[model samples]
Target: MRIAIVNPNTTQSMTQAAAASAGSAARSDTVLIEVTASTGVASVESHVDEAWGALSVVTEIERCEASAERPDAYVVACFGDTGVSAAREAAAGPVVGMTEAALMTASLVAHRFAVITMPKRTLRQSEQVVRNLGLEHRCTVLAVDETVAELAEGSLHLLDLFTAEGRLALDAYDAEAIVLGCAGLADLVGPLQAALGVPVIEGVAAAVTIAEGLVAQSLTTSRALTWARSSSPSEAVSA
Candidate 1:
């Protein structure tokens, strides 16, 4: 199966990190197509940022669809699941959002899970995502005082902050598992999991695995209603 992992942010390092994590979780036969946004903010932190990032996500998917090596599935590697709806409309294959995939994966393993995101401002965005997926009852969203740029740098201090937040999720929220809520934090899964001594789910890896499974089952996004593409003017007139 061919899976395209699209990082909505313009940062190449974050895209590399997401691709590496996806590569680790994917089957040997699965081919990964890595793509970074050509235009967008450095990191998607707010509704404004997501608004800009969404365009890049759809553009990349459209570009891939026009290529000879069109992917069998696509993974939107953002905790916010940036441009997922638009990407689904633009791609011929299944599109999996990292946040949705991670939350679903967490629900399967643990009764309750917590999402730890960055920059503090995205807490509401994360919460909205959980609600949108109808997982609000089983999930909690927390924020750490770090930025996506800081996460890309990968420092021990950042690890400590994540560890502290993970413990809080376990203790205060009664969370059974931890979900890292940013694609930039993909590389921290092993370390954070070891520190928390519980399931630490990274969205990129979960999304990639889910995308591969969807392809294996020959399932693509349904274009019957919500994801239906608008017809061109000529096609509309012909109809």
Candidate 2:
């Protein structure tokens, strides 16, 4: 199966990070086409950015669908899941959002969850996403320490410091799961999960796995709105 992994921003580093995180989680036979948006905000830190960044993601999904090698499913590589619902309408496959995907994955293994985001802005966005997904009952907190951009371009020396903050949030909130709330933080899933003694999840990888399942099930975007209802007859007479 072919899966299109779209990093809905212009940053190459974020795209590279997302691809690396999704590597092992994808099906061995799956072909992942990593893509980046050409025109969009750099990173989504607020609702306005989240709303705006969506257009770029939808545009990329349209491009992917029109290609000969159409993706079976599409992974939107933004933690905020910008434009996911709209992309779902444009694509002939499932459109998985990182925020929804991570929460779903974490919920399967944990009773309570908390998102470890970057800075105050992202933390607020994360909370909004949780509420949007109606996961407030299952999620305990949305915590942030470092700015995701800083973490993306900054230092490996801060890993321990950041992870410790995440661990504390989990403990204090009685969270059984810790979601790394940046597509930029995708690389730290393995070590963090081990160290935290809980599922330390990355949105990028979680979205990929969910996309694979959607593909296997032959499920695509449902045309209930913009695409509208079918009006044409197939002309193949029913028996």
Candidate 3:
């Protein structure tokens, strides 16, 4: 199966990092295609960025669907799961978002999960994902005074800040799992997991794994009702 990992931001470095993590978790037979948005912000750290990023991501998905060799599934390489619904509507296969992937993965492994992400500005977006999943009671969203760019730069101070906040979340929320709240945080999963002595869920990894599993099971997004097309029958069938 072929999986397209699309970064909503224009940063090729971030796309590379996300692709590396997704590639590591994918099976040998699965082909991974990585793409960075042609037009969007350098990084997505706030609601405004997310709004613009989602548009670019949807365009990328539509571009892929227009390709001669379309991917079997598409994974949005942003922690916020930006443009997931639109991608699904525009594609013939599954569309996976990092945030949803991470949260669902954590929910399966732990009774309670805590998210460690950026400060108040973007915290609500992540929190809403938890609530929308009906896992609000079992999940806690905590913020760090850091940006996606800062984390992606591999700053030790940012790592330290994350680790400190992670520990606090474990104690305060009594969480059994720690979900990294940004795709930029994927590289820190191993060390953070080791340091916290619990399962640390990284969205990119979780999204790829879940995408692979769903593909292997021959499962695509259901177009039954929720994603039912509003267009004509011919257009809907083609979509």
Candidate 4:
């Protein structure tokens, strides 16, 4: 099966890191198609950035669909699950978002989970994502004093910050699991998990496994209602 991992941001390094994380969880027979959005902000941090990122996601999926190696499924590798709905509407395959996949995976392993993301500004957005997914009661969103660019640098000091935050989540919030809230933090899962001694869920890996499962079960996005593609203005007029 072929899976396309779409990094909504234009950052090539982040895309590569996310794809590598996804690759670690994928089956040997599964092929991963990596796509970095051709036009979007350097990193998706704000709502405006998310909007642009989402557009890039739809564009990439449409481009992929027109290619010879159309993927069997797609993973939107943004922690906010940016452009997921648009991607779903544009693709014929199952679309998985990092936030939803990671939160859901965390829920399965532990009853209460806390999401650790960066920049602090996206804390509300992360909270809303959990609420939108109906997991608000089971999850908490925590932020660190760091930006996506800082996280991308993959510094050992950033790992220390994450470890400290994870400890806070576990001790104060009674969180049983910790969810990495950004795709850029994919590579830190092992070290963070080791430091926290609890389940540390990375959305890229979780999403890959979920996408693979969906494909193996022969399940694709349901085009019956909400995700159904609407006719274009011209087509609608003709009809």
Candidate 3: which stretches are off by over 4 Å?
A: 155-157, 230-239
> Model 4 lDDT vs. the true structure?
0.88
Q: Each candidate: what lDDT?
A: 0.88, 0.77, 0.85, 0.88
lDDT string, candidate 2, 1-239, tens digits = 88888987777777877887787688789888889888877776776777767878877877786788887888888876778767776777788988899998888989888887766666666777889889898886555556556655533555786578777867788888888777877556766777787778888888889888877888777777765433222222541
- Candidate 4 lDDT tens digits, 21-114: 8999999999999999998799988889889999899888888988988899999999889988878878888999988999889989999999
Relative to the true structure, candidate 3 reaches a TM of 0.93
Residue pairs with colliding backbones in model 2 are none
* Candidate 2, position 141, lDDT: 56
What is the per-residue lDDT of model 3 for residues 24-114, given as tens digits with 9 covering 90 to 100?
A: 8889888999989999899887888989998898889888988999999989988768888777877788889999999999989999889
The TM-score that candidate 1 achieves is 0.94
Error of 3 at 222 (Å): 1.5
- Provide the lowest-lDDT 10-residue window in model 1: 227-236
**lDDT per residue (tens digit) for residues 68-168 in model 1:** 98899999999888899888888889999999999999999999999998879988878878999899989989989777788576544578888999999
TM-score of each: 0.94, 0.87, 0.93, 0.95
Cα miss at 219, model 4 (Å)?
0.6
Model 3 residue 173 CA deviation (Å) reads 1.0
Ten residues in sequence with the least summed lDDT for candidate 2: 230-239
